[model samples]
Target: MPKLTFAADLQWRRRFARAAEGLALRFALEDARDLRDEPDGADDPDHVPLPVHRDDYDFDACTDMFFQDTDVLMLYNARFDGIEDPGGETNQQIGMGDLCTAAWFDPFGNVKTRDPHRGFRR
Candidate 1:
């Protein structure tokens, strides 16, 4: 991985700081104190879907579980690929498909994991 320049680092910091602002996140009751692996209603045959918006449930239990903290990722860069003077030392020959790890697919339907040897052989 190429070491990003100071400017690039600053840009990313700003981007993340921006994304963190006014971010409305959803959360269940924090009264449990421990973490848990709640099964999805659709996936769990025994799970009854929560009624629309409001239902009452007792908070007291043997709930010894905690959830992973929400991770905030801001996918932005001062320089990008596929254009003239895209900057950021993007040499796609040696298999660094993109400087970005967040763009799973591009507009042209090309995945970001393309390599010279990962395609059809003629």
Candidate 2:
């Protein structure tokens, strides 16, 4: 199954956090409206997710994270950094509107420079 639980989030987030810390990259995390049933977000920080794909379009619109208030620090997908929904309609919604905010920075902490750090784009 696709990993979507808190355990998975911890693994991925910590990996990214470590690398960011190593580079001395500075950033702050905003509050998140997490979906997982937890006591609170402060005690359990929410992690940014890459492009998500939900196979079952018929049952749930699966725009599960659309309203999530947390701003993403960075989002790197191997290719086409876009969310995928089987039906195609939901993808359009996310693309056209409410695309989650992502904060990308270089080693010096410049956000979205024209040089495009590591050739990654917004």
Candidate 3:
């Protein structure tokens, strides 16, 4: 796993900030382990702590702080967009096109064939 530098983190924050326009949602670059476990326990046996300049001990509690009573929550698995599995024989990985295809539907299962590149060209 590659560690994110401070510069990279700031860059990503800016990108997300731009993308989150009119969404009224707060963005955070949270660690995977912090989201998975409490402070006192080991989240996973294979977990290896990555070095980050800052630590947010209350990240889990603060994640939903911006949500209101009327807000509808929709979480997308962005990791699926570019994760490669080394254990697979073919070294399977998901592409941006695949993610776009998978998410080209409304909550009611209505297909929307809009090109993803029109908005975000990742």
Candidate 3: Cα lDDT at 106: 22
* Position 31, candidate 1: lDDT: 28
- Model 2 C-alpha lDDT per residue in residues 68-121, reported as the tens digit of each score: 222221223323243323234654654533333221222333333243233322
TM-score on alpha carbons, each prediction? 0.20, 0.20, 0.20
In model 2, where do residues sit more than 4 Å from their true spots?
A: 1-11, 16-88, 96-122
Instruction: For model 3, name the residue pairs that clash.
Output: none
State the lDDT of candidate 1 residue by residue for 1-122, as single tens digits.
Answer: 21232335544544434433223222244422222234443345444464533323323331222212221111223343231122434433333344342321222343243342343322
Among all candidates shown, the one with the greatest lDDT: 3
lDDT of each: 0.32, 0.32, 0.35
Model 3 C-alpha lDDT per residue in residues 1-113, reported as the tens digit of each score:
11211234544544444445324433332444444566643444554484433544555455545332211121233333223233333323321121121221222234343
- On lDDT, who's better, 2 or 3? 3
Q: Report each candidate's C-alpha RMSD, comma-separated, in the order given.
A: 16.3, 15.5, 14.3
* Candidate 1: stretches off by over 4 Å: 1-8, 21-122
lDDT winner between 1 and 3, please give it: 3
